[model samples]
Target chain A: MPGNRWALRYCGNMLSLTIKEVSLALREGKISPLELCRKCLKRIKKTQHLNAYITVTEELALKQAEEAESRLLQGVYQGILDGIPFAVKDNFCTENIRTTCASRMLKDFLPPYNATVVQKLLDQGAVLVGKTNMDEFAMGSGSTDGVFGPVRNPWSYAAPYREQSGGAEDDSEWVITGGSSGGSGAAVTSLTSFLALGSDTGGSTRNPGALCGAVALKPTYGLLSRHGLIPLVNSMDVPGIVTRSTSDAAIVLEVLQGRDLKDSTTVQSPTSHAGFSEDFDVRNLCVGIPKEYHAPGLSQETLAQWSRLADLLEGAGARVREVSLPHTQHSIVCYHVLCCAEVASNMARFDGLEYGHRSTEDSSTDAMYAASRHEGFNAVVRGRILSGNFFLLQQNYERYFLKAQQVRRLIAEDFEHAFSAGVDVLLTPTTLSDAASYSHFIQADNRTRSTQEDVFTQPANLAGLPAVSVPTALSSRGLPIGLQLIGPAFQDGMLLSVAHWIEQRVGFPSISNYEVPNK
Target chain B: MLGIHQIYGRRRVQLNIILPLLCRYYYASRTDNMLSTNVKTLRKTRNTPSRPVTVARLYSSNKHNSKVPKVPTWEPLGEDRIPSLPQVSSDLVDKLERLALVDFRTKEGLVCLERAIRFADHLNMVDTTGVEPMDSVLEHGQLFLRGDTVTEGDCAEKLLPLSNTTVEEYFVAPPGNIPLPRREERASMLKHSEF
Candidate 1:
């Protein structure tokens, strides 16, 4: 019956409807929740070789869908996401489901309780499709650290092009699916899940979104409950959304945002205002262009693409001003020190004595701690933890850790000052360069290159402000380049609104190379 | 505050121990001619008279050296010599009682900073200055030790009138002569050792 229903709705096998469109179709009797869920599962099965998911719960998903269909028939829809299927980054806890942070540490551990975000989605009748793969402990800037395997760039599957000179040349370079939200990006791009939730401490949400050619929004810190989402840094971490479109991202965010008692960091601020889907007037809005973000080394093509975006906004009657955030240069260093220090402290709880994988060696307590951590953490995570510990050491704490906090305060003040000067949103490139190939990312020089790319995005994270990466143009090489829109803290709705407007003005390429079949 | 004074007193004792050594050596050289002669002879024999005689030699002097009076080396008290009983001040006890009279009275605020630092060092949570970062240590300490008591039952009901009694007698009851669990049965008991 569900197969027949999907066949009818997806006539000609070309149903590219978003989660919102699918929900509306179900409500109007054009399709059923069961039908939509089955189609999503079918798509997942077809793309299984893509290695996007760590675990797929087909049986649990169908059982939940049947319940949702029963509710739909009874006219008792829970909310917008009811019966809509979504995926969560494996770092999030799911009751009775294997919630690995794509590390062997949690390979067999099952959380007894669900993360607050997961519970909220499930309560709204969102069927969980599967847990997507990610960097171990959400540490890497690429998905290569995952235990399952590195998630390949879907854009890499594009067919070779004929050279102007002679023969066909293969252009299938393995693009880096920016991480630690890499799998979330891949899930949406590969159409395995309509939407996915990810935690962004640094640029985990936006980086992957830009790389995978998806719409990602990192909500303002303290706007969403982080009770169950394991933290990298408590002060900076925020739950974000990755989806096919800005509208779908807005829908998922609206459902996920609110004050939770368990998470004391969440505050009742004015930016927590509801109704994000309402019409947004961007004609009179002032968008700031930080001169520092337009530094040298930005690819010529990306700069050209940015100029076009500026012209498009100016044509739409929005004023673009060149603003200065003087403290932007120090944000990368400050973020690394603060985030790594917090990582060192927060991750100390997994001592193998309490939870996670334990070493079988009969060793002393200190040896056990060392063995467990060495066995549990990957290279990137261990490097960061070591770096953080070094900073927090007696000889270096004040010089690095305290100074980093001072710099973080200055960064936040910079944003506050800019906003006070009448800028509604700030625009910058999501990355300094286009997504690098996986091979390039492994080379020694790539570390410096990646850190430089993060220079534009790290300031927003340092300020704990809301930011969204909306793909604006493709590189000359046909790779996607993103334009970031940032807003004041708790102004998630406003940021999303501005992004939605930009999405309308300059349409992004949502379908990457793999999504298009061979002609 | 009392714990602070105790630590300050300990530091003062250490200083006292070092100060008397200098004074005793100086007085011995000035008043005792035979000892001074022996010191000179020893220095001359060693061929390094420019170097000051170390304090270690003072403690190693034999009783047979009649000119040198046998100086007693003071040793700090061992753990067994010091009382193990909990020493709650009357003022603190009365304050706690008065505070408990209020329905929503806050918990005790008396924190031993030295103990806190030791705990932080034990857990390897120290900051760059070789000092325990006070914020996190205080947080973890408050979580672990708040509302905890040395003895069970209400302090007011059990020990209020017995203020003159020593802590060991007033708090700790006599152990009953019950048979202990066998090693086989007690093997699982180790799991509950966390508390």
Candidate 2:
């Protein structure tokens, strides 16, 4: 039996097992679904300072656990994910659950139906743990601006929290979990849940995946249905998966992906991938290092691991070459116009007249619209909505909106050109650096932060390619630094296979490997 | 929109056939065995991308193409030239307030609006000549349209109460006869909003 300290501080050691191990343990009758559910709830309470979860579905989870236990006893359990516990980002709708996108506007909003991905997981018998917090309506990059306070990095466990006696609200002291999907990343890394669903508009999932040392997968647009994911940018938004390993991500992706008639953008013809082989020779792989991803803010540590990982692949007999995506410099700017344009269109739905946050100050319909929007959305959301409309105006339409679309073509073609030149996957750094301290990060406003932070990852979004962030190494500050792998669209399985390869080779300590003493 | 090749590939395959095949694939690549399948490793041929629609960009026929746009006031990672945004005047912001229904009267709102515009202006640096504007990520704007039919119904019971301002089945809204909030009304609304 383990000592009290080891048992008390369960994570980072005891609960480090990935979904595969846990599934086997469950299958062998070594693990109880109810016990696992209770333990996860207990861990969530223990790490309340992290503030990773928005709401814990303890009652629903326990009920589901009982069902899972009964199914196992009857030997009629669903496949691999039968009793697996997972979390969904608050942005995804879970029927009857208060699915706030961490915004006051929808704090009391109960989703009428489950998001496609969430429903698919539940259908496969995966236990729904809770909704992870995110940037309100998934607007900001550094998950700090949400209505619920910023999610602190688990690596910052020793760092003082605001509510704690010695903790101060000084931002510089707290390490920010990279946003939008920051909570999902923190949850998976903290072992609060085995896998969490996140929506990646522009690196929201992968950004935090890097900071929190979890494997993040942003599947190709239309690969996974987006029926009920609260829309941020309709064109670019894709359901993202964060997990302990690339294999865990792949299994979840397989379960959740397919054509849903409700989502018109879903790819109609689903191709069953030829399974990945563990013994597939590295010589068959061709890796391209995008030259443009070496932008100004890239830290030395990130750059070195990026190179070191390439060297590892090369040593394994894979062909590695530096490739160029020249239009990358313009992608972030192009994304702003496109993303905001969609954000404007999507956000127009939040009038107080309909569901969600009606204002009492309704002198006129117009007054109600104005006041409700003002009260409903946070400043970041409102600002984006405003600027998006500005771009859509008749005068600026050609100059900004139309021009940005043309620029998006160049960005997409740049990825296409690189991939067409006999490259299998493009390897790049996910974030410029590891996670940023709150005080240092808040210095730049949200837009500027997203611009620099998403340089490497946004190009993949623009091209509609699949990408995954694999934690490659620890930074000088001992924070996790992840590198990204971008593969061609519709080649989702191949992308995961390559990610799984790097994942095994790097053996970068999983979150549980971090020897942080439990507070 | 799916390009030609993707559209051609995405035909209406029966879900029954797809499901069984999907199951086989899933069982074959179960999480524990996903990376460890010892299949005969064949040299995989690259999937050639067939359809090509030039990425979205403006026409080469524009007169202003001669005078290339330049980013006057922005740089990435916070070396901002000037965030005040003198180009966007108070009058322009007021007009935008009426148009977008967002508050810019506050100092914080003003600064945020300036930051967003200044950041967006960086798009001026890219010379998008001869590029066909990418209208959608899918090729030729391909959306999988199912046969038009009612996907859901009888949801008034579920959706109506979402807004407490509803009167019976009708969501209560201010009368349409009145115009949009005037400047003074907006000021009072802003005060009410406490922004």
Candidate 3:
């Protein structure tokens, strides 16, 4: 077993250890952060085919790990994240490292400033191993649209080489790693990093979490600052955390959550008021399963897992009941319109003039503008920007943009009503099904397919609710099926507590079946 | 080439059924040419009162006007001419060209635009009267304004090198033909010029 294999490599079974356990071990002088860094780096190098990282900051990570090791020796730990190897999505602006967002447009673009979360993690002595790959400009739900190519799911079997075929048999057929945060999820799942940061617009984080079998959190909007997050849809976007366990997500959340002067949209008060505890009692909590979420096209396995989770919750003393969110039917539509409108506005900044890729097709400024945009953005991003601009047109505004915004309010009201009526959290499927094989996924047009995939995840974003996707069971394909727990705004802690409890009950398997010995 | 003709053919059929005016417009403008030439031919074909708006008339126009045509004024097509084709000519492409200053149009651009409209039509079916449009999710919180105090003062020296086209103290950019600096050029210059 991998656990036994890990025991032979380190003092104990390091592969199965959570972030909190690692922290405890570090504090007790059982292991050094340098050793941890070395192990993580070795794993990252070994799994290079996963394409999980856009940029690996080996020098920076080792330097930070060395500092962390000395601090541990001096008995001056910088709290939980100190020396913990982690990664950030490429969209987050790292000070010196290239933050490409997996787009050719900003392939060489380095930020002059760090994102608020990046600075926060650095302050806590977190060792940043790399910047992970993402959908170009966070515009896609499938990871294949990334500039560096698709990140393969770590759980996907890599068939042995076949001499008859003169190639590895079926190795070229990759399983989908769900997008936007696909690389982060893969990194965390494969134990390349203990914690990784992702961003959730609709289902960017949770989609990958379900596919990669990682715990992913999209906290309440504005709780975390967006000062340095490359905006997709600013109102719905939040910095998501991906980790092996819910507690690791919580630990990272606590370290990153705070009021930031840089991001005015951040809540005025600090997140300290909403305290998180993994040990909260689930006895008296009420879990609501929205009826509208049980729509057609949901896989049999996912539905079964959903039912099993509700049964597990009810068996553990939480009241489970069917709740009606009538507006859920209209969520995907509203999400699309609003997302396009905002994306059109936000992307206006990317004209061939400044920091990103400038088209060399020079004739006139106007021609250059068109050429740059056409060349800079992928087909998917260009499609959104064009559609968004169309929706915001004077004649179409009332019919599309304004109407979508009104429906958005209805969506939010549905959540407020459910929460006000005593439901502490909503239980739903994280994705329509398990990870789609690459060949199966590329059949339909990307925009249509992506919209359908966001059906379960978009409503929470439209309503500005905090949601966590926790893996509950493995599909018949040995891929994971995640169940999402969504809570009202500012109740992120309570939402995570329920997720943690479910995680404990399920005992979901990890994909880290390999371990490197500490040097 | 690359199956775009098939997409256009499919779009033309759908446009004919749903929006006859747009179908005539699309037919009158069908060409394996740039957006400018198509727009020019569309303006000429639309202005002619002799031609009956039909699929046959569209094909005939394409056959007869296969030769290079005279350059026409790039007048933005009015809403009436491209009626109800929210995916193709909902003033978004025009605005992107004129206001947003982007001009690139690909063969499948209209197809992608149509997909978004189809998605919006899904939302348009829902009734949402009396519900106030929400800009953000926060209900009770007021805009938290920061004090007008200097935080980290100018760091242009650190920021300018991020862009390769920087001049002595500023980033170099394309010149505006107009007296006022073009919004496009200025933004391109200032994004990396932190000071």
Candidate 4:
């Protein structure tokens, strides 16, 4: 009601509004939360061909929107996000809502309790739009491995080609929405939802956000609570935020960050809120460019854009220097060892005899367990489990698992030393290249491809550092290419502030031209 | 003479029951052709009305009415698509299955196992020594264990409905061949074994 006296002026439709704009509209009585929900639902229905959502919580969304409208009318609105509609990746449990982590094992598993983050958002009057799809068990770099089917990148949908010769080929390839949080990225990119939550473990959130042209933040480990967030790699897992801009990501991060009794990994005291102003001074900021990150697989377009961004920052009085993170070369291998080892331990609980899908085999308990898991999990998940079990074995434990852990510490220390030496933030490419075609992506093995995809992103997770993917340029094929900015642990505010400055200067083009009706 | 006749009749009936069971047990353990034939013969004679025993199935399937989805087909990739690595032997796969409680015997499972081994080969290239392994991401915090208290009180009644095999107040599992000692069986065998 504070902004209600302002003149209510909105564009033709609500789909173009950001979360901040939507909240302002709600407060100014330009549109009711119910109206906003209905518009979003319509957009979602229109974009069904994208396959971004596994379950659309239509009824629940309408109910919450009604509550928000009533609160607004009573002059007791919650905050800026009071009536915002958003989606979360299906991995997070919602009370009585089906949370299938894109695997058949949890296809029908309904959690009896809500994840702490979901409860926090709902308490702030954020309307739950639906649950988006992802890579099964968050194990792959592409979202094609989901049981519900793959999510197509909204930016990569090319129109049917007309042939001069008489024979026509159908769209031979569909562009992949990078995973395992691809659906959430696609949802926000296509303007089907105002915002969405993606869980980042080794770039699950940033990869998709980069490909889909959205802002994704993987906050520093322990800065945000991880309770009830179905773990992929518990030590590196953090709930990430996906939005159209850096400010929205920061706002949502504020709403979600806290110290929780249920999660022991959180900071002892609540960190300060992520507040940033347009006038936040970024002059003379020291930006590090890790020389090792300029690897062999990086594309020419991405490299050019990365260089251009550095020049822009330098022109704005920031010192862009090539800083050496010596351990960067081994981070990916170290990440794989730790990720698999942790996955082996975390996935043991889904033996099908407990909360997930059970096998029909009654032969023996052991046989039943094997059969259930074999039938429930996909190839990607099964591969990780096998590799994890091997690394954690007593015979190989010292050689593989223990050594990887030591290397992991070195990687974290590298970031610590770099930050301690007055490097304000480290700038790198979010991914090796732009989004690949489904045909090209599946050509390689899932593990190999995933490792390649996470090369630039996983180090942030391994070091327990905060990182964000900001879309900076377009590739020749017209796909979005994102650059990453990572800061020291618990320095998320400074990291995001510099990212915000870059975002305003770049003013990158979004994916609006590809919203064609499904043929 | 009359008592002997009655005893012989009882012995004949007992033999009829024990003979089929013995054949089944032998058939299960042995790969001999003659033993398998004997099992078949016993099974054929099992339907005779003289020894009436009914085996009822609590679960039945309506397979005819249910429609099973077809498996998706995809174009196969050439050998070059898959990077060659140290091949995991079948024995190693079996060990992995035992450790993971997941099968890798099927086609898809085998493919997954091969891919995993290939990924492991990549991790093997790194050299690490004297570095402490970080089991957790916590920099300076120690594990905080909660006080021993009843956080989750009795929720058996709420949880019973979650499974399909709930009977009365207990969740039931399919009875298997493994002979687990039950509470009633323990009470009955108290005299034979030390408590």
lDDT of 3 at A127: 93
Clashes of each: 2, 18, 1, 0
C-alpha RMSD by candidate, in order: 28.1, 14.9, 18.1, 24.9
Winner by TM-score between candidate 3 and candidate 1: 3
- lDDT digits (tens) for residues B1-195 of candidate 2: 112131112223333343223211000112342222111111112243232212211122211211111111123535353333436777777778877877765778777766677777777778887888887678855677777778779989998878868787888888766766667668877678653
My TM-score estimates for the predictions, one after another, are 0.70, 0.84, 0.81, 0.81
TM-score per model (chain B)? 0.16, 0.51, 0.42, 0.41
TM, chain A, every candidate: 0.93, 0.94, 0.94, 0.95
Which digits, one per residue and each the tens of the lDDT, describe model 3 over residues A1-519? 312222322466564578998888877767678889988898889888889999999998999999998887788988887888889999999998999989877889889989999899999988999999888898777787888988888766421101111233446556778987999988888788988899999999998988888999999888889889999998899999999998888888888877789988888434454467768787889989887787667876676567667766775687887788888877887899999899989988886565787766444565556556666777788778777877887977998899999999998989989999999999988898888877878787778767767878988888888999998765644467899999988888888888988877665656543222111
Query: Which parts of model 4 are misplaced by more than 4 Å?
Result: A1-9, A158-170, A268-275, A513-519, B1-87, B107-115, B121-125, B142-152, B175-195
Over A83-162, each residue of candidate 2 has an lDDT whose tens digit, in order, gives: 88899999999999999999988989998899988989999888998999889999888898899989888866532122
Model 1, residue B112: distance off in Å is: 39
Candidate 2 lDDT (Cα, 0 to 1): 0.76
Proportion of native contacts present in model 4: 0.29
Clashing residue pairs, candidate 3?
A370-B103
Candidate 1, residue A256: the lDDT equals: 81
* Better structure of 1 and 4 per lDDT: 4
- Pairs clashing in candidate 4? none
B44: Cα error in model 3, Å: 71
For model 1, residues A171-280, the per-residue Cα lDDT tens digits are 34556677778888878877767899887887888988887778899887776788778778777788879988888988888788776756656655564454465468
